[model samples]
Target: MKTSFVSNLAIQSAMRLTIQQTQAELLKRSQEQTTGIHYDLGLTLGATTSRSLNLQRELDRMSAMKSTNAVVTQRLSASQGALETMQKAAEKVRDTLVTYKGNDGVDAMKILKTEVNGALQIFTSAANTSFNGEFLFSGINTDVKPLAEYNSVPPSAAKAAFDTALTNYMSANSLTDMSQFTPAQMQDFISNTLEPMFTGPGWDANWSDASSQNMTSRISASEVIESSTNANTKSFRMFALASVISSELMDKNVNSQVRNTISNAAFGYVEQAIAGLNGERSSLGISESRVKKATTSLEAQQKLLNTHILDINGIDQIETATRVNTLKTQLDTSYALTSRLQQMSLLNYL
Candidate 1:
């Protein structure tokens, strides 16, 4: 019943299959040892494959978020620095005006005007600060400059409005002395003309390069934060109005009465601006802290995800190497045995 001999073709085929299987095992072991990761995830985590895959996807998404957050942190840091510099310039201007309020000396006034102009220029440059080619103070209009030049050859809309009001006041009263105008008239001009010029449609016409909608970025799964500032903010407008008043008062053609009115207004505006600037600083500081905190938390999350992923897919190098070595030895021994068997003739069995 068992007299059938094994054919040469069958023996060859079995040997080939065995060799192929050994080679495949060797390759897998080598790969696992080199990479410290299993080649076949399904084989490594058969029952938990779906869970592991979801975790991997989460890890990938978190990695992308971390990368984006780094850029956001840089921009926020830069913005904070620029705003600090801007606030300092405004403070200096305010202090200087307060210190020399009643001094009408040519030399003293000249020095004050020079300082005001310098501070204004510094503030203007800060307002136009950029990071990675995007304007920081432009709100959603990242590509547009947030402010026109402080002494633009063609006056800004706000400045033109002020000029027109001044001309009308002089023409209507037939008065050379702006002092002739009562306190009520001066108040009316400021309320109806200058203040309104920095808000609503006037704000859009004068300085805003930004939309009302701010730029926002997701800092976490459930959290988003504003990533932009704008020239139209009340704090920025207050500083701008103060600067314009100081610059105009420096004109020698303007009388002492006009200069006094402008100086008093400028002083009040500067004081108010300091308070507004403090609020702006407070808000920005809070946002910066949040960004830093989010970054730290995200980094911790990513580290945990990496550890979890490794737990699921990582192979032990020592064990994998040992398995490879055993396979190689087995394959070599099989080849040697096969060769010996081939050499043995049927006559040897007699």
Candidate 2:
């Protein structure tokens, strides 16, 4: 038999390497046991790793969309509340006009004027409402206020333009007092001048900074909806015109005939405003429903993708735990053997 000489140093080095490898395996199996997933996905899944990566990427995208949809739902809810506020104010004015129509009594006229002014303030304030630091009714111009306050100090441009137009109309007609204002004259001025002021470029220049186009949001991969309304719509214009006419002329010294005409016109405009605003509310409600449905669909897809990813990368927890325990025992035995080797020195023998 051939005898080979092996140094204690070489045996200790081999034991040290074995201990290190055993500890590394123990750590890996422990992690897999705790997490119930493979410690190294690329190694275990091999060629299927690409499919797992793709599924995980799609799942992340759906998660991001769900977060975005939450913000969109909040914005839409806030917009709906603002529209309700405007609608309530308009309804108050409508009720006042209907209750006190054709009555030129001092108390009734004062009440009518107060309600009209209050409605205008409420309408403008609602239209200029902001959410998340952006104007809800400014459409694409989210940073800009939609409607200027009509009763501001020194008067807003809209008020100034309206005053100027009235002054010019009075001068041209040579009317000394509003009581001398005839129904024919008032109707002509309203149709030819006042209506255009509220509905034309004049409104953009003086009253509203809102865009005609509304804000739209993507609710799903293939679906988009308008998430906001704008103050530049015809409904908003009609509400402003009705409020202006009632505020400026309702308590004037005009005869009952002209006052009745003015009341009738305002009543008609208010009715239209109410109907149009309701339509806008309905449209937003539809968008809210679609957002909810899209969220549901995304959640279902996310659950399915998550299951697929787990199937690709998941480990058998019971088997992993058994392997981990076995590695721990081996590592402990190796540690003991290494300590024994370290102590087996020639000095100890001496």
Candidate 3:
């Protein structure tokens, strides 16, 4: 064939382009083999872009849930510890009071008084407990301390009223002996006077915890959990009443009959308090277990989502290696051809 100048130049340009294209292909495949993910994800995941993006978004949400759940779990754990400690203190006082019931010894009452005071302090301190600057027992009022300090100077108005009523009632009745007081009279004093102080307007006035509302956290797409407990529950009320009555019983000015009646009341209240505490602990335990299970499930889902994303965009190592070798051979062949064509000329052909 008699090749024209323009035709020969066009052939050489086409050969050079072919060699460059093959070299680029070799580089791409080599990178794919080394990285496993495609060098050009947009091209590799062309049709599946939407699916992969959705999966990634879901995974991100799951990760975020895990992080928040960790914080919730920590707070719940701290609350649980405080509850258990308070429970133990209440139980110890209950056992001692029961042991010394009806003894009426001045020395014994003194010891029991000390124990009751200690239990009260423990319950109050636990109620005011905080985790990471948030009050654990304040329900949604995380920023507020849940309980008043047990012995505030000058006394709370409610405490002052309580102190005066018990003293005046004892003096007005002219009953110096606790045996003169009936359980019904003590019940009247408690229901009409003291219980209201712990559970009704006085409690609301002094404490910062919400009435019954629990804090909730959403740990997954389908799961929401009560992440906090409040201080105004029946358990706390029972504990408060028991602690207060026991403290009252310790007053030597109160007749033995009054002390005995108060001790009996304290016994009943402490027993009920223990039962209530157990129930609260069980409920919180179940909540914790559910949160943990949800966390584990979310983690597993996140792993699966990552796998699916890799499936959409990841390269097969074996296939990438084979393609790299093949592209290298093609580029080598193209280079050899281009070099030979470069060396060739009309003079050589002639």
Candidate 4:
């Protein structure tokens, strides 16, 4: 009987230790959830959170790209509006020269010349347009103004330089009709315009990537009109019409025709700029669409990953509570059994 009691006592002690160890493990897991990886709980919550952070960062980058695109779009929209106004003026100039072909009037010619000079200034301003401190039409030369100013030079000198430049542009293309345009056509225009100034050459690297912010920025400064898209906000056909009109006025001894012709040519450059702007708009649209799609898809993926991470690491409080209560009951039973064994000595058992 004494041997049996000793043996039972040994078993009771071992069983209590086992119960305590099990409770300790439960407590450790709980702590891990609360304290992250460094805590005694040793839960996967910290790892899950880390993954979530990485996804969030990528989302943030995509969001920033979208914001950048929005700004560029707005700027382009404003530029297009300006181009439209300039085109109307160019058409009017053409009509005037056509009107003055036989009508001899000094006062009328003076008025037309004034309007033409005003148009010239407007178009030059457009070419020199800037956004946030960088020139929009200067290609890669953001700081350098694309249109030259000749306030210090005499009117004839200015006209001579301007006409020479235009003639150079026309001759450089050897392109009689501004109908079809490709990447090569555009590059040829740029080369023709910049080549005279630089013996070396135009920088072909200005638009190396589709995502080039600078490329989009230089949209409205083409040297000549290829199509209506390239047509000055006014239109190349319209500019040619104006030139014909100006020549008619010159034939009729209208003094304003010469100045008006020069002004019309400059503004015509503004008209062709529309094509470049449209190209940029198209590019921006594609970029924006891609960014939005990518962002949305990435967000969805991130959300799913987050859900997975939660499942891996998150605890069900209700379930845990139930478990804890059950463990407590078992522990209490063990303690009670231990007490019974300790108290029930051989003498007491009798």
Q: Pick the candidate with the highest TM-score.
A: 2
Tens-place lDDT per residue, model 1, 1-350, is 56877765567667767878998999988888888888898977898888888988998887788788888878888888888888998898898888777667778788888888898889989989999999888888899988876576777666676677678866876757654665555656665677777765777776766666677888877778887667778878888878777776544444466556667887788777778777776776777788778878988998998898888889888888889999999789768766765666768788
Candidate 1 residue 296 C-alpha distance from true site, Å:
2.2
The model with the greatest lDDT is 2
Score candidate 3 by lDDT.
0.79
* Poorest 10 consecutive residues by lDDT, candidate 2: 186-195
Candidate 3 lDDT over residue span 1-350, tens digit each: 78755666677899889888888888888888877788887776787877877887888889999999899899889989989988997897798788877777878878888888887888888878899998888888888877765556878654676677777776777757655666666767876778777767677766445546878999789988898888888888888778877776555545566567777778888898899888878878888998899999998888888888888878889888888888888888878877877887789878
| Minimal lDDT window, size 10, model 1 | 249-258
Sort by TM-score, top down from the best: 2, 1, 3, 4
Q: What is the TM-score of each candidate against the true structure?
A: 0.84, 0.94, 0.78, 0.44
- Judge candidate 2 at residue 50 and give its lDDT: 93
The true-structure Cα RMSD of candidate 3 reads: 5.2
Worst 10 residues of 4 by lDDT: 202-211
Candidate 2 off by > 4 Å: 1-5
- Residue 83 in model 3: shift from native, Å? 1.0
The true-versus-predicted C-alpha distance at residue 95 of model 1, in Å, is 2.4
1-350: candidate 2 lDDT, tens digit per residue:
89987887899999989988988888898888878789999998889999988998999989999998999999999999999999998898899899999799988899899988998999989998999999999999999999988878988898889889988998999987888889998887787878899989999998899988999988789999999999998889889989988988889889998898899888888888999899999999999999999999999999999888888889988888888888888888988888888898889878
Task: Kindly indicate the candidate among 3 and 4 with the higher TM-score.
Answer: 3
